[model samples]
Target: MLDLHRLRLLRELSHRGTLAAVAEALSYSPSAISQQLAQLEHETGVPLLEKAGRRVRLTEQAEILVRHTETVLGQLERAEADLAASLREVTGLLRVAAFQTAALTLVPNAVTALARSHPGLRLRIRQIDPEQAIPTLTARDYDVVLGEEYPGQPQPRVPGVSLHRLGRDPLRLAVPDSFDAADLADLASAPWAMEPSGTSPRRWAQTVCRTAGFEPDIRFESTDMVFHASLVATGHAASLLPDLVWAATPIPGRLLTLPGSPARTLFMAVREGAHDHPAITAFHTALRTSLTTLKTTLPLPTTEADPAS
Candidate 1:
């Protein structure tokens, strides 16, 4: 019989597209991953991978195995969910992946609520970008993912995950108080600090800046939004900021609205049928309650209301 564990490795290879990525996500070495997949090939008597340049591609037999793996995994998830439902108490470990912004703002409240309400269930939260969050979730590395989508750059749907809309987070322009710009378009040439390239925030920022008629003079790149806020607050650089940045504090710098009052959707995703699991439900409820509290306590800053991202 084919080893279920090695079968999972094949599925992960299909999802991640490279051995190095799969190894990194699962905390295994590339050679180890290769050896296990080779074992599976021996058992099945088929070529599961073919060399293409410096990388590898899945063979037809591997694709067939992946389809079966998906079904087997989904069934296992349902079984686990069912078993958990049979119990009176929510117990077990739930691994969660969230980006920096949500981790700071809403995730804490969720964790607190879960700890108080379901004392037996433990949740592990890791800071990860949405770009990598969902794929890792599919690899069974994380049970839940808290993520956000920019206005135009929506994440493509991954198989075997159920997505839930959490809230809409607005993106705003952060200009230094010492800076002088009467209109939003006038700051195009100013020094800017933004999230690193290829991130959702950076993509949206570039698009909006181009539409405003100038490329940004991005002088600083950091994944930490707190740093971005600090840059603007200290009058060092202008930045594209999010509502989450000011959720726990007073407005740090002057805020400008995007052209259309654009916003990114905050979301949660879980293994397909595991949404109904007791622990997952409890976490989701806590997230909603925390979001409600944030909206009530953090009053939206008054702005002139112009067009933006």
Candidate 2:
């Protein structure tokens, strides 16, 4: 029988795209990863990798094995979940990755609730860039991921992960104290601060601007919305920010509800079969409770005059 552990290594290589990355994710050395893949090749009696100048690519045979490995891992997750659910308490470590805003607003409350509700369960979290978060979750580096999707751009479906929409956070135009705009187009020539180029938020902001009939003079680029808020607060630039920014820390600035006033969909993703794990379930319950609290407590704008009022 093939080694299930080695099969996982092969699958991880596919997901992570390099031996060093797989080793870092699983806490092994690159040499060890190479040796294990070599052993797998010996067992199967077929070459499973082709060296491509400092990196390795999986062979067709290795890809086939990874497909089977995915099935096996998923089944194991279901089995583990079934066994865990038969017990009286949920107990395990859950690693989570999230971007800045959710980490600020939702994670703290969820962590507190989980501590009170499931004393035996533990959580480890990391702040990850939006581009890398879900991909890392797919490689089994995280048990769950906090993610957001802007309206009109559905994330492409990733295999073997289950996603649940948490709630929607409204997006609004943030301007320096002196800036004024009756409509999005009025600020066409204004300086803008946005997430770095190639990110979903940057692309979305660009689209929002282009639709308004001019390209923004992008004055600053950063992934941190807090920084975006600061730039707006100080009159350095304008930006499109989400409600979660203020949900974390209230800052003095003008927030305007744009035309259509799109809202971003917040969601969580876990491995497909692993979604039934009791610890994950408990965490999800806590997060939903936090969302409810935000609904009642977060100061969502009622109308254009409300922020001024």
What's the TM-score of each model vs. the native?
0.88, 0.89
lDDT per residue for candidate 2 within 201-267, as digits (tens), equals 8888899999888999998999989988989988888999987788776754777898875878888
What's model 2's overall lDDT?
0.85
Give the number of the best model, judged by lDDT: 1
Q: What is candidate 1's local distance difference test score?
A: 0.86
Clashing pairs in 1: 258-307, 258-308, 259-307, 259-308, 260-308, 262-309
Give candidate 2 misplaced runs (Cα > 4 Å): 17-21, 50-60, 303-309
Candidate 1 lDDT, tens digit per residue, 190-269?
Answer: 99998889787899889989988999999999999988888888889998877887875557678888777787888899
Error of 1 at 280 (Å): 1.4
Model 2 poorest 10 in a row by lDDT = 300-309
lDDT of each: 0.86, 0.85
| CA RMSD of all predictions | 3.2, 3.6
